[model samples]
Target: MKLHGTVPVMLLPFRADESIDEAPFRKQVDFAIEAGAVAVCAPGFATEFYKLSDPERYWVAKTLVEQTARRVPAFVSTGCGSAHATIEFSQYAESMGADGLMVVAPKWCALGVKELTAFYEAVCRSVKIPVMLQDADFTGAGLPAKLFVELAERCPNFRFAKLEVLLPGSKCAEIIHLSGGKLQVLYGLGGVAMMDGLAHGATGMIPGSALVEVYAKIFRLYGAGQVDQARALFHRLLPYLVFALQHLELAVGIEKRVLYRRGVFPSDRLREPTLHLDNDYQKQMDELVDAVIGLVNEVKAATATRG
Candidate 1:
């Protein structure tokens, strides 16, 4: 089966003193699985990947693979500025039994298509598992449709692409059409455009892990042809989704805080220099969740019925 559905970009839990809180992090993974996520991904942007050291990065990947233990696919972001480090991390993830890898374009300098393609080709060549290109405008090196097509055609392992752009539905559709459905497309942006992306032929989504059950409901409802129901749920989720995307750098902190509020995370403490919402924003998020409680319960009923 393809790696599909609400694959959460997990948040790394932290202790009061800023240490990695391993226990809560693992439980967060279990919570996502119990909530019906088709796969679990970690050390993505939401996981504070940039803040993690080399050893910490490997530990997160290792822990995710071990905890998931094949319950669902496990993917880790292994992109680095140089091909050698990328390959090293990619191979390490494969060694640790990761199901696949998500790689963004090399950073610090914008390179031409030829250099970008060569970078991806090198990483794909070094690993046997599938590789996903993370196409995000924030990366300053978003893959154009043509370059994406070339990567798909040139690398057999290049089988998935996750788009993090505005108005992603058309881009999602174009990728699906241009790649002949050979490359499965997913969208991010806290799933604000999830329904639109799905309608445009995205196979699935990879949103933050705060409310995996809700996202799972949307994905399952849509796939089951309950289009109207899915749209309703997606709209219900927009308040929090909008809040989550308010600041690009603060997205992970917002997710961690929500998870903490939901009791899925031990604490919302993040590494230094991350944002923390004040009481006002917290009250807003609380109200948003309150408004959606009924819909959330309805999703539970719907999921049980479908099962």
Candidate 2:
């Protein structure tokens, strides 16, 4: 399937006791689809994949694929620390009907190009569905464009890239150019550089699920040549993106809080080893949400009316 447009990485809803809340989890899936998301993703970094047990991860992948029910693409993040494990999970996701797989290299230690290439090749070869390489290096030194081109040539299923570096425009341009337009690029990093990435030829964005409709509006506006309006709307929401992305754990916590406030989630309970939002941070988050909640509600209403 062609993966494009705003595909939000879903927040895993939890009850006050910290167990996975299945009812709200399914509600979130329906909410994203109703809000105009082209696709939905799960167990991403934003979903706190590291904190989940293996069974929970598999359950999440199964639940997302089942819940999406082919209404839109459901891409599962299956990047384990070992190539063997990654391939195992990828196969499982494919069997569970995931439309695609998003794989990130092991972040515990830096692997050379040869090792990384081998790892990705094995994964692409293992699954029949398309694979999206997630270049999530916070240091901004992501894998080389040459490696991406070579992988695309070698693995016919390696058709997409999710660029999550510090600044992704240049890398997006380089990869698209090098891959002869065969590799579709999507931008992450909470869609902070979304406008820039679009200007550089990114096909889509994978942002958090709290504001899927808002991002969809910005994307549609830009695609319709309403650049100025898109810019204005994106700028209005930039502060919240910047605030939430200050840290990974902070992003997860804040996004859950936003979902809770929106009534998509019943509670904003995060798993352990999480960054607790202090009172000052909570106050600031409340203020930022206050600034954008109206726009969010407006977009949701318009989308529902159109649908």
Which one wins on lDDT? 2
Q: Score candidate 1 by lDDT.
A: 0.84
lDDT (C-alpha) at residue 90 in model 1: 96
Candidate 2 lDDT by residue in tens digits, 35-147: 88998998899888999999999999999999999999999999999998999999999999999999999888879999999999999999899999999987666898889
Could you tell me how far off, in angstroms, the CA of residue 264 lies in candidate 2 after the best superposition? 1.1
The TM-scores of all predictions, comma-separated, are 0.93, 0.97
lDDT against the true structure, per candidate, is 0.84, 0.90
Which regions in candidate 1 have their CA more than 4 angstroms from the true location? 138-141, 292-295, 301-307
lDDT tens digits, residues 173-237, model 1? 78888989899988877777788888899877888887788888787778889999889878888
Candidate 2: lDDT over CA atoms? Answer: 0.90
Candidate closest to the true structure, highest TM-score: 2
